[model samples]
Structures are given as C-alpha cells and as structure tokens.
Target: MGSMSPIRGCRRTIMMSSVLLFFVGGMSATDGAPPTWTFVTGGRIVGSPVVTETGRVYAVAEDRYLYAVEHGVARWRYDLRVRPIGPIRVSPDGTVVVRTRADSLVAVNPGGGTVWAYRHRTEIASFEHGGDGHVLIGDSAGVITALSATGRVVFRVAVGDSPVTTILRGSGYNLFAATRDGRLAAITDGGARVFRRLFEARIEAMASTADRVIIALSDGRLIAVDTFGREVWTIGVPEAARRLGVAGAHIALISDNAVWFFDNSGITVGDDRFDGLGDTVIAGDGVFVAAGNAVYSVRASQPRAPVARFSSGVGAIGAGGGRVAIGTDDWVLSSFGNAHATSRPGIGARVPYWRTSYDYLFLKDQISAGTDQAVRATREMISRVDRADLAGSYHTIRELLIEVATPRTPRTGRVIPPDVRSAAVRALGRLGDAVVRDFLARAVAAETDPLVMVAIFDAFTDTGIVSPEPILEIAARYLSRARGAELSGEIARAGVDLVIAAHRYAGYVPDVGVELLRRAMEAPFPREIREYALTAARQIDGR
Candidate 1:
C-alpha cells in the first residue's frame, strides 16, 4: 500500500502510472467473465484523469505529456518538459489546469490550445481552478501560488517543505491552503495570507462541504471546523489513504483500501469492499477503483453492485449521468453504464485483492531497487497484476519491479517468483487445515528453488509442521546426501543469523544442522552460515 515517492512512498505529487499494451478483455455482470485490455502508450499516467462537462477526458502520463481522449480514442496532447505529476483539474465552467514538478502551471482551452502558461517560482504540486478565475497550486517547497485567470502571477506564500494540502475555496472567493507544517492559513485568490491557525500537526487536506470545512491532517486525523475556524469535530483515520473527497454534504474516503462514506453528520452510512487502487475518486453515486490495468465502478450499497469495468492503470475517473469517464496509463474510456462482459482475459473485481495481496512482497522488492521515478512507473505496473490471465507476465513483471526497486543493488530483491507450490505452502500454513500439511511437507522436501524452499520453511514453521526432528532430518539430508551446497548457501543467504536467532528462541537449533555446519565448515557455503549454526547449537543445545 506504500505510494511511489522518493523520501516517502505515499505522496501523490510525483507519482506516475504507465503500462504497455496488454490484452485482458472479458467482463460480465457475474463473477466469472473475460476482461478486455488495450495498449495505449503516451507515458506514465500517474495523475488522475479528469473529465469536463462536455465528456472529454483529460489525462497526463510520465512522458511529461498531457492528452485528451474521447470515447476510447486519442485526441490532442500537450507535451511538457517536466512530467505532470498530479491530476488535471477543471473549473466548473470548463477551463483545464495542469501542474508539474517543474512548478510549471499551464491552462488550456477545450480545444487543447494553451490559454495561459506560467512557471511557478518553484515546482508546483496538485492544484485546482476556482470558479472565481483563480488557479490555486501547492508545491513541495511549502509554497502556495495563486494565479489570475490570465496566467499572471498573483502572489506566492511559503508553507513548508511538504506538498501543499488541497487548495480549498469557500464562499466569496475566500481561499485556504493546508500546510504540513501544522498551519492552516486563510488566503485570498492572490495568495495573501489573511489568517492562520496552529494545529496539532501538519494538515494534509482541506475541503468545504456545503456548511462546514474538512481538514485532514498528517496525523491521519480529520478536523471539521466551522466557517469561523473553530473546531467542531475531529475524526481519526489510523491508516492513511491517497485521496480525500468531500462534497454534497457527504465525505468519501478510504483507509486500507476500503472506501468509507460519511455523511455531513459524519456518520458512516456506506462503504465499498476493500480493493487496492492506485488511484480513486468520489463523484456522483459510485466508488471507482483504478486498479492494475483497469477501472471498476462499485456502487455504494448494502452489497455494492458493479456498474462498469474497464482496463487497469486507470489513473483518473469522473462520474456523471450514468457515465463514468476513466483514464488509464495509455487509454481512456467514457463508459456509459456499460455492464457488458469481454471475451479476452480482463481483470474483474478480484483484481484489487489479488494485486494488493501478492504484490506487497514485490512492492517491497521494487522499492529496494531504484529511484523514485522508476518506482513510480513500477508501482502502477504492480497495481495491475492478474497472473492467471496471461495478459500480464507475473515473472517478467516481477523482474521489471525488481529492476525498478533497487536497480543498482540487483544482487538482492530478485528473489524467484513464488510458484503455485510455494503459494500452496503459504496457503496451507494460513488455513491451519491439517489435511494439506503432508502435501506441503512433501513439496518442501522436493523443492529446488532456495527462495521458495525458505518460504516453504516459513510456511511449515507457521503451521507448526516442522519441528526439531524434521529440521534435523532435512539438515542431515542437505549435509551429506543432498548434493547442493550452493543451494544450502543460498538458504544461508538471507542471513543464518536470523535463522539461528529463531532456533535459539524455538529450541530447535538442530544437532544435524550443526554437524552439517561442522562438516561443510570449509565447503562453498559462506562462513556466516556455519558460524551461526554452530554458535546457536552450542549456545542452546543443552549439551
């Protein structure tokens, strides 16, 4: 669930979501259906896609380019030097505003012509266009910029090093900028700091809901204040989510991938089932999931119903009048309540779970591999994983992520992909069902992959299937008969220190493991393996 950022992996400002052509198409009203997939290449589409009243979908990709799409076809594109990291925002009337890490702000007309362009004093983060002819922007340098409708720089004020909180506007063109530096300031459209309040921590989000204000803070807490800036209610969200949506007397948010719908009264009324989403939005009546190569619309109800589903890598979604405008890494779709299923392999509702479930391990690997930008692209790739459908290569995919996570430190984070056997072992351990214990034990006995074997070892450990007796037996086999010292060394790779530490705690530091250590003390295995095993047995063997 960690976002793809350099310092912290959860920030949205620099993220990008881009994946190449994949063919997974099949989606029906029922549980089992084909998912359709298409390849649309422009660049990483990390920023959420936006749709105006006319139904044109606006999206940006990592190629540092912004594009407009309609009805699944490409339109005009605006290429930029610095990638647009946040979603394109549209004013209620139809003006489009885009922000880039370069602090470059640009506005365009509906025809994709540049209406105004102004490079900020520093890189601007997420921004919004106010109906009052002002564009509000927040940047990583803790500065907020307000520009006139004509792109004239109005005023700039420093906030802190963190990205600006959501630019919030209220009645009479009053503007508020939330800062992570623990201050909420009332500013005019010109970016003049009118008033300020000291809060508990940095505020991450600020929004207006008809009558009250919603300010979500860095501490994973939400503070509702009145128009006068007095605190009314404070709600705490222990697990942070990516985006916050508040409008029409309702609050839509997520924690741990579960969408929580709260009314203006702040009462929890509805929630969509938990599913991992690279990005999400709250608009109209449905909760949309921009999961790994596709987008899905799940209604907010007693049992959420599926309204429409499209390819993963979808970075943005806008809902209205039975239509949901979706933007993916490469393509865009304006689904007008289409519930039709596909024939090609396409991700269904289970994507968010499977991708997030198995991808956590891979996500860690990718993070350990590379730069924040490489990781930004990698995160979007993992977000769209569905191995059963050959549309996505799980192994090649993992390799790509490993390259991105620790690109320079390639020696590690390249662990072999867990096959069904390893996955079965983990499953048995988790299920606690005794029936599969022997099967998992046998599979472990015959396993060849060192990484998979250790994972098997953990599964058996988790299931209490491996005791000192079996450990000793396996150690004896590996010691003399099992002719694979290299593999033994591989098992010894994750650090025999932790293994010995666990043995010291569990009283299972096997005598045979010790004998193997003693016999192969000079073998190909690293000195650390022998040292730890010998040290552990001597320390705890009751000899």
Candidate 2:
C-alpha cells in the first residue's frame, strides 16, 4: 500500500519577506504547526480555489455548485448545473467563468449573478482568458474559437486535424494552442495566423511568460519558442515532464518523481525529488507544490527545502496578491493569514491533525523506533534556522545524529541496514544554522569510522562550512599515515571530499587542500590519491 502516513506563497517584495518569516520562524515557535483557516464546503472540490484581491474565495465542487466564500462563511453559491469541465477562473475584471461538461461556458458576476452563456458544438477540451476580457476555447473536434466579453464569437476556425489539448493567452489578443498530434499554433485575435510548428513528440505541457512559450514533450525535451514559433532554446531532461508552470524567470517541470527548475537561459537552478506531486505554483520567491494531502512551499532564492507546509486534501492551489489558497478533496477551502471580509472576527477552532507533523513524526520514529521497524517518514525541513526556535530544531538534530552517526545499525540481525546517515546529514544542512554546523563539526571529529567521516565531510559542505581547520588537521594526519605504510584509501578519499567541499561552500579551495594536493601530485603518495587530488585541484582551479 502507498505509505498511509502520507506526505506532501505570494506577495510582492514585502509580501515575500513576510511569507519567509512566517514559515522560517513560525514552524518551531508554534509547536511546529503553521496557522491555517479552513472553510468547510458541501462536497468535494473539483477545481482550484481562487482568491480575489479583496480576499474573497471562489471554488467549484463536484456537487455542481460554485461557492463564493467570504472568510469562513458562504457569501453566495451558484448552481453550475453540471460538473465543471475545467478550473473555475476569475478574469482580470472580476468575471467568474466555469465550463461545464455539457460543453457550455457560463460566466457569472462577482455577486453570484449569471452574466451570460455560450454553447459550443463539441466538448471543450481547454480554455483560457485573453487578459483583455476575451475567452479562448478549444474543442475536441480540432476547432479553436474566441469569444468577446459579452459571449459574442470573435473568431472560429479549424486549426488542426486532431483534438486541441492546450490553449493559452499570449501578449495582447494573441492565442496559443497545441493539438494531440504534436502541432502548436498561434493566431491573432482577428483570426489571422501567426505561425504553426509540428514536432516529433506530443506536447505534454505548456507555460508562457510575456515573451516566450515553453513546451515539454513526451520525449523528455523542453523547448522555448517565440511568438513566431521559432525555437529559442531546448533542454533535455532525464524524464518526460508530466506538468509544467512558469513563475517569473524560473520554469518548474514535474517529471515522474522529481521537480526540476530551470531559468530562461536553459540553466538548471533547482532540482529535487518528491513523491506523488500533483500540482505546482510559483509565487513571490518560492515554489509551492501539492502532493498527497499537503502543500509544500520551497523558496526559490535559497535552498531547495520545504520552508512551509499546509495540511489538507489539497486537490488544487492558487496564489497571488499576497494570499495563498487551496481546494481539497474533503471539500474544504483554506487560506493562510490574510485580511478579508468575514462574518466572524477570529479564526475557527483548530482542526486536529491525524499526524501532528510529518517532519516531527519522522524525527520521532528515527529516534524511538527499532532499526528493524519499517517506519515511514518524510525528508522535509529545508529553511532558515535561528536561535529563536533552537530547542526543537536542536532536539531533532540530535535524533538525526543518533540515527546516522552511530557506528552500526541498532539491530545486528538486520540484513540491509537503512542508509539514514546520509539523509540525516542532508537534513542537517537543510536546517542550515550555527548550531547544526557546530554539531556536525563535532561529529566529524568524534567519528572513527572512515566511511562515516566521508558522510560528515559531505554534510559539512552542504551546510556551507568552508575553511574547516580542525577537520583538515585530522585529514592531514591520516594522509601521512596512509603514505607511510597503511595505505588507507578511505582517508585519502576524505581529503578529496574536503577539497571539493571547500570549493563548493566558499567558492574556492582553501590553502590546506591546495598545498596538500600539489605535494601529493609531486611525490610517492599512492597513485589513486595523487590522481584524485589532481582532479579535485583542477576542478577547484577551474571554478
């Protein structure tokens, strides 16, 4: 069975800073729980929750209703009459539109009154709003249509020979679409074609900024194209991208089990693995991912670690204007810390969590469970750490050290011991603070096993520890002994690790590694150590 204990931002500049502080400081201060306000709905939410500028929340449910929620109470609800065919969208001018499986587009006013309806001949496969109060629709019959603000048909034309799978609004009144047969087409608002391009692989996902449109293919290729359909740059990923989205210059691509972030120049900025990721959004300086029953927020400017997490059966998420909101399979709509219209003054009663916190449970299991127990946990906790919440953070760090720094597995009968040590060190680095750094440095000194020492050095590098004088002193002693007679390859390997760590942590090799590497290359040190040191020196020098 899938692990039952499952797992799983916005703002302008000031909004971004507030969000960072909320998660960075709020988690440990509030007993490791981030504050959340949830509004219960009548049925399962089928679409993403939309939060307006004034903090009103709108969401669609499988029960054929669209709800307008103000604070924790329903302001009004309109019967959608049929299941929503697409996500409920609020236009720039505050017109709410939802497409039904009946192949009709329904527009509603902000006060829950019906505005207009446009009926289509075939089932609508995709739809998007043209920013200037125009609706773009694509149907399974290979037709593309544009409707004005009043539901008047602006243009209707056949674009391809297969179903239109994607539709998006570009600069001004231009519309872009992709077909099932690997065709991409762009047209102006007046029905004039700009360009069309065909590819060998089917387009799996498409996202655009103001100037470029990015498409991810089934063959694990991502291509950025201009408005004229000219290729700008392409990147070959390890796996086919299942979903794609753009947040500023950062492009987020979700493959089978990992999330990859790339800049417009095609250089990778962030990459990490998370299981069961369902949706992703980039707002402010962070990337928000929805997985299982949780929404995880990872900062883009800093380390690729989850800084904040909100627990719910998150089906879809949306964030903008300094507010973050989510819709869940449990029919609950939630918002985190924003002022808005509310019938009540304070928040509702806290919703008790089945598992208090995933990270907390993982740490507890690591410390309390026997090595033989098949305990499940999450590798979360990637954010800035400080002294304000040092108690819990240090306690968890100690548990990690017990699990990882131990000489052997707790159980002798174990056949394949868990590799929790490396994970533990990585967690320590993700924690990223003076306490963590000091603990790791002490662990490196006390550790006798060569293999564990290697892991400790790697962790030190990840935690931004450069110019480690004490570790270097120990490494020089071991290197000298290996040169004498013992020939300890592991010790030499640790020296090489420190060399690389210096380069990565502080952007340059320290004097210790450089001097030792040069000496090893000249004389009777073992051939393996000489070769490794030479390679490390070259890498450091190149950087």
Candidate 3:
C-alpha cells in the first residue's frame, strides 16, 4: 500500500524584496497527532501564484480554476473547463491568460469571467504572454504553440528533446524552452529552428534576466548563458540542484532542504546562516524563497527574515505588483497582510473550495475497499474542523474540508496541517493500494517543502531493480521550480536516494548499481543520511 499526501510556487522571475518582519511563538508544527499537518491558507493563489505590486497574491491550481485571494478570503475565481497546471500570463492590458490541462489557451477579464478560450491538439503543459498579446506555449509531446489575443492558434512546432520549461522574451519575440535532456530551444517569430544543447545532465530549471539566461542543471551547475547561447559563467554547487527563479539581478535557487541566492554575476551572496530570504538586512536583495514553514527574503550581502510564518512549509511563492501569495498542502492559496488583502471585500460570501473536490472519491470509490476507508477518514476529519475548538487560520479551512473532500473520507479527527503530512506518508508505506500511489504523486507535484517529500520516500517503491531514475526524474523537475540552497541540495539527494532505497523492496534486483554507488561517493548529504542511503544501495548491489 502507498502512503497518502505531498504538496508543492513562484514569484518574480522571483527576487526582490523590500519587506521584513520578526516572527515569534510559532504555531503547531504538528497537531500532536501520530502524524499531522498544519495547512496554511490566506493568499492569492493563481496557477502561477506570484506576489504582485502592493502585496496582492495570485495563483492557479488543479481545481481548473484561477484565484485572486488576499488575506484568508478569495478575491475572485475564474473557472475553467479543465485543470490548469500552467503558469499564468498577466498581459499589459490587465488581461489574465491561462492554459488549461485540456490544452486550451484562454483569456479572462479581471472580473474572473472568460473572454476567450483556445483548444489545441495536445494538453498544454505551460504558457506565457508576450507583446501584442501573443501567447507562447509548449505541449506534452514537445510541441510549441503560439496564440494571438483572440484565442487563435498561430504557430505549433515541435521543439526540444523534452521541453519541460519555457519563456517568451525579447521585443523580437524569442522563445526559450529548457528541456529534460539538457538542451535549450529558441523559437523565433518565423519559427522554432534555433536550438542548443548544453550540459551532460537534465536541465531542471531555467531563468532569465534582461540579458542573461540561467540554466539549473541536474548535475548541480548553475550555468549562465547569453542570448547567443554562449556559456557565460558556470557556478557549481556541492550537490546537484535547481534554480527556482530570478528577479531583477537577484537569483533564488534550491538544492534539497535549504534555499540560497546569487547575483547577476553568479556569486553566492545571500544569507546562509539563517532562513536566507525575506529579511530586513537583505532589504534590497530582490530574491524571495519559500522553504519549510516560512517564506524568506534575501539580498546579496545580508541575512534574512520571515515574511509571514506558517506552521507548514510553503508549497510555492508567487509575487506580482505590491503583494505575494503562497500555496500550501491543503491546496489553499493564501496571502499576507497587504492593502488588497485587507481591503479586498470578502469573496462576497462565496463558498470555499470547488464542487469537484469531493468528486475524486466517487471516481476512485469502486477501486477498492481501502479507498472507501481512506475517503471516509478524510471526510470525518473535515467535520471536526467545523466543530472542533480550533482557532487561527484553520477556522477558514472548515468549509474547504467539507467542500473539497468526499463525505466517504471526511478526513478523520483533527485537521491535518500540511507541515506534518510527511510523517503520515512515511507511516502509510506498508499499504500498497493504488489510491496511495496516486495521492503520493499529487503530494510530490505540489510539495514546496522537502521534508514532506522525504516522508514520501518511505511510502512508495518503484518495485524494480531499485533504479534511482524515477526519483531523480522527480527531483530534477522539482529543482526546476525550487528556490534556495538548503532545499535544493536535500531534495536532489533525497530524490536520487529514494531510487536507490527502492531497491530494498525488490529483494532480488540486479548488482549493477553504478548510480547508487556514485551517489554514495559524491552525494552532499549529512553523514547519517548518506550512510542510510549507502546501506539501501548495498542491499540492491549485495555488496
């Protein structure tokens, strides 16, 4: 059986912060349950939730919806016909552009109503808006699609070996796509003939300032490239990591557990002794990082502080205009106290969560008896949230539990906060149900904190020769959006280690464990974690 739970955001391309605050008396990291989570809500969470000017946050989620939430209440919701897994493109005209999971490119009015929707041949993995309302997008099969303002498809060309991330830039309309196989593809207005492959490993993430293109390689190198695709400077870290995003000249990237920063020159210059982001000292640092339990502010020369501390680690950080938004395990979008957050009227008494939240249970109910039990537990837990003597932001989540969860699961007992789902995931490893498998995948996709992913490592086993490929694959994609030092390194190692660790479950796998041994030799983990990984590797190799 598999263990359930994991959740994983965004901001300035995101570096640049002039805000700071001191945090005291943190909330329950765990609700004292055998394994618990403390999910946080109160922000704008669009699919690509980013902090905006004046402190408003925006984000979109799998709910097939886009949200503008400030404080604990939603500002508006624009429903889509399908899921939205792509980043949002805010046009200069104040138009909100979104790419749906069904491969539709749609434009929305600021009022949360649809203005246009364009469908394509394949599911759209992502999208971006450029000048004259031209939207650039890439599909699951490595094809790029360009659409005009009126939802008409203009260009659809195949690009990259495995295009995972992309950006549209330059007044001349140059498109950049970072691929899984260590390549960057550039598409011009005429077509996407420009291409360049770099590094021996995967390109986990990509970022660009006005003049520089930054690539976060799967092998742990932060390689800077010019517009001509020429390597500028390559900064390598102790462990293979990913670059989350860059704001102005400030860059935020992550390895496993900790988040860190660099400058336009590619030097590690942010606070390393503390949280590393959102600090008074790094007031002008332009870098923002969301780590376990906190969203950080960092500058090149100073230490950092917390912007709004939550019990759970942030799944993502998004910034726009003057505000910031965050996503948590509970799948809720939250923002800090900004004018929009404060002045924004109640979501006009709209209900929290979508009607489809509980529908997942019906979809999987016939799968097994275990599925039924799990669903019932979740729903039960949600009910307690309504009557339990809970205080704080959790009060706002009661409605979500009822709406998002199926009555069959009711989620049992006290509210499980996002911070502690890791323990629950670890404990549920013995159950091999498919429900567990799917939930685990979801947890990983939205997980912003590595501790939670670490917990998941114990739950699901690939059941093969203990190949680290799957885990590495997940880590590579995760590092693509992950920011900061502490987090980048830990997650990269864990993802790889999980691959080696899975061998323990096979009992009769192969002895050709080159990746495992290599990881044992070169992985940048604490002695204890390294030794554990080595033992798991040895089990597969019989060494």
Candidate 4:
C-alpha cells in the first residue's frame, strides 16, 4: 500500500488493516486485482450504467452522449442532443431506451441507430420496462402511458394529481405505480385500475419481491403490500430509505447511514453501517453499494467490505453480464468481474461523526437561559456549528427559540424583552431550513413588536423557501392594513425589510408576490420601502 496524499477538505480517513484476510459466511477478501477495463467518458456520468447480457455497457453523461463499450473498448457513441434523465435501460428486444431532458424517449438499435423516439407533452417523471416489450412511462400530469416497442401508445390512464415517481411490474400482468404524494395505485395490464393506497408521507423508493411490493416513505417507514394491494407488514427506521433493491427474498433499504435488510415477512435479517451516501443495486446473491469513492459488495451472510475503490467519488453503479460497472465523478467508467478485487491495499476513507460534540448542549443551555448575553453567545455558536450537525440540533434550537420569543404574560401586555426575542429570531433565520417558515410566519402575524417583526421577515427570507405563497399572502394582507394610515418609523422599517425579502423570488414566481409588492409601493410608507417595492415589481415584470 502506498501513502495516500492528503485529500483536500477531508477531515479524516480510515486505514485498512493488512492482517485482515478472513472470509466470513462464504465471502472471501478481495484478491486485489485491477479492473478488467476502464473507459473515460466525455463528462460526468449522470446515472447508473446498464450492462446487457452480451457484455455491452451503456452509459450516459452530462455531455449529452450515450456511450457503448464492450470489454473496455468503445463500441459506438450516439449524440442525444440533450442531457438524459435517470438510468439508461434496455428493452427485451435489445434496444437501448433513454429518457431525455426534452421530455422524450429515444430508442437505439443494436448498431447504434435511432430506432424510434416518443415525446411526451409533460415532463416524464418515471418509467419502467414491461414484460411484453412495452415501455411504461409516468408523466408529471399524473398520466401513465404504455408505449409498445414500436413507439406506439398502447394505453394511458390518469392515476392521481401528484406526479408518479416509480413504476413496477408485478406478477401475472399486474402493475404498480407510486406517486410523489404517497399514493400507490395498482393497475392491470389493460389499464384497469385495481386498487389504490395512500400513505402519510412522500414515497421515496419502491421495489417488488415475489409476492409483495415494498414501498419506502420519506418519513422512514417501509410498507409491503400483496398482489391485491392489501397491507402485509410495516417497519420503521431512523432515516428515510433513498433506494431499495431486492435480491431473491431479501430486500435492501439504503439510507444515508446504513443498509438494512429485511426478509419476506419484514423481519430484520442483517445490517451494515458506513459513512457517506451513495447508490445501490442487487445483482445475483450480493448487494453492490456505492459509497463515497468505493463500491462494496455485501452478501446477505457477510459483513460489508469494499470490492473496488476509485480515486474519485463514485457517481453511479450497475451490475449485469457477470460484472460490475462503476461511473466515477472524474468522468471515468470502469468494469470488473464478479470476483472481489481491490485497486490497492490500505486505502479507504470515512467521514468523521461530529454529532458527539458537547458544544450543542452548551449552546442549547445558553439559548434557553434567555439572557441578552446568553442569546448573543448562542447565536455565535449556532453560526459556527457545522451544517451536518444541524439535523441533530435543529429541533432543540427551534423549540428554545420559540419558547424565548413567546410572551409569557400576554394578559398583562408584558412580553419577553424585544432585543432577546429579536436575537433569537435572527438565530432561527440563520438555520437556513424551510421547515421553520410556518413558525416564523405565525410569529410575524401575532407579534406586536416592530423590531421582532423585522427580524422575523429577515429570517423568513433566510430560510431559502421555494414556496413563498403563504408568506407572500400574509404580507399582502399586512400591507393592505397600512394603506391609508400613518406608518410609524419602526413599522416602515419592517415593511422595507419585508419588501426586500419578497424581491428574492422575482422571476421564479413572478405572480406570487406581485400584489404584496404593489401594495408596498402605494402605501403611506417611507420612500425606501416604496423604492424597494418598485424595483421588485419591475424585476418581476421583466422590465
């Protein structure tokens, strides 16, 4: 093993042990062989590579080119003229199918010729290949369309309002479609709706076993339903599952911190923890996990270990044709045989877990104290805390801030000191999470202190909220209240801040906050408020 060069901005690295050569549960240590073949792509790979049964690999890159490689050599390249979306797939007839950013699906023949192309009127959300050589596509309009191998529409059905995120083919001509809003619909092959089930959270990923369809929710719940759409079982984890893969009767749920395996009845089989996050695919009897810069092949009976490591971060991974294909962030694609291989010994990295720091407890205590100096110190500490630690501390900090900012004696008209409240609001704003947007909106509506109002408006802006309709509507109502009345100095200052915050969404949602900005421009408000409002409105109008 060679000494590793220092990785820029990396805090820690794990050194592989030399004496570790034991085989566990029929899985042996890698023989440390090099990759069978390596190919460099024109750009970073967008999704996982697809390997056909004939050892041909298909990969798409950001450069808008679909590459074909066999045995480490470039076979042919086709220009799609637009970046492809999602992973490239092959139909039963050996035609390559790829969806593009232009809302079209292009199928290429074995000789790299365009066989046919199908364009959708709406954005293609998800797609899957059916058993009868048909392409099942789900669009943003909640319509599922099945196209024959010749690019003809076989049938179309409207599932629901939310965009479909996944499509799976079940047993005996049964099909399943899951939407973004947590609605799973089971449809027959002839477009007849069988049943539909709705969950409480967003559907993140889905996979199917022999007799059950596994659904993963954004709230960290896994559900299994039978062919008749009846709930079979459910389980919970700490983090949401990003991807799901099925190997025989075992299901693998890949989350940020770990890979959990469950049996046919939702019983825990085995699990492995690793740092960083990546994609996974189940091939043969093993689950290939791409994490950080390495791809680890984990058998159901063995602990996780890296089979291949790369110099750069892995972008995507795929397994087929008795080999594993990996795409790296450095614009390279490589293939290796099923046997365990390693580029070199004693080379691995793990991100340090910083959640164990004691500073979070100290900051929480100081913020809860609610003194002016304590709040100030807490604010400084919040800014210094790493963003990774925010997940662990966000709820604690938010609750403390809400408690300190709320008035304890509303009946007597006595409130928490405005300065302390304002500081806490500013700290909440610095959290940069939109989950607190509703709380900030409610505080702005109920608070009477103008200084705190200004802080709340600024915090709302700092949340980086993509959906600003609710807050914008509130601003319009507030502006309407001050239309003909004399605006106090502090009130005018807060109004100006609100206008400035509303300006950030000018072109993205031109119509959302236009009424609020117009109201700001017409009020008995100060000249600064009117100027900001006028500028914002013009930007929205593209003047």
- By TM-score, rank the candidates, best first: 4, 2, 1, 3
Residues 17-43, model 3: lDDT tens digits:
101111123211222112111223222
Report residue 517 deviation for candidate 1 (angstroms).
Answer: 75
lDDT of each: 0.52, 0.61, 0.49, 0.65
Name the better of 1 and 4 by lDDT: 4
Model 2, backbone clash pairs (residues 3+ apart or across chains), number: 0
Candidate 2 C-alpha lDDT tens digits along 440-532 = 777776765555565666566544434556666667665665664443555566677776765543345557767656655655667887798
In model 1, which regions exceed 4 Å deviation?
1-46, 62-65, 72-75, 81-83, 157-163, 190-194, 291-301, 308-322, 328-334, 337-543
Return the TM-score for each candidate structure.
0.51, 0.55, 0.48, 0.57
Candidate 2 has an lDDT of 0.61
Best by TM-score: 4
How far does residue 26 in candidate 2 sit from its true spot (Å)? 7.8
- Candidate 1: tens digits of C-alpha lDDT, residues 103-176: 57677776666778776655565587753577777776666655677886544455445667567765333466
Measured by lDDT, the strongest candidate is 4
Off by over 4 Å in 4: 1-28, 35-38, 339-543
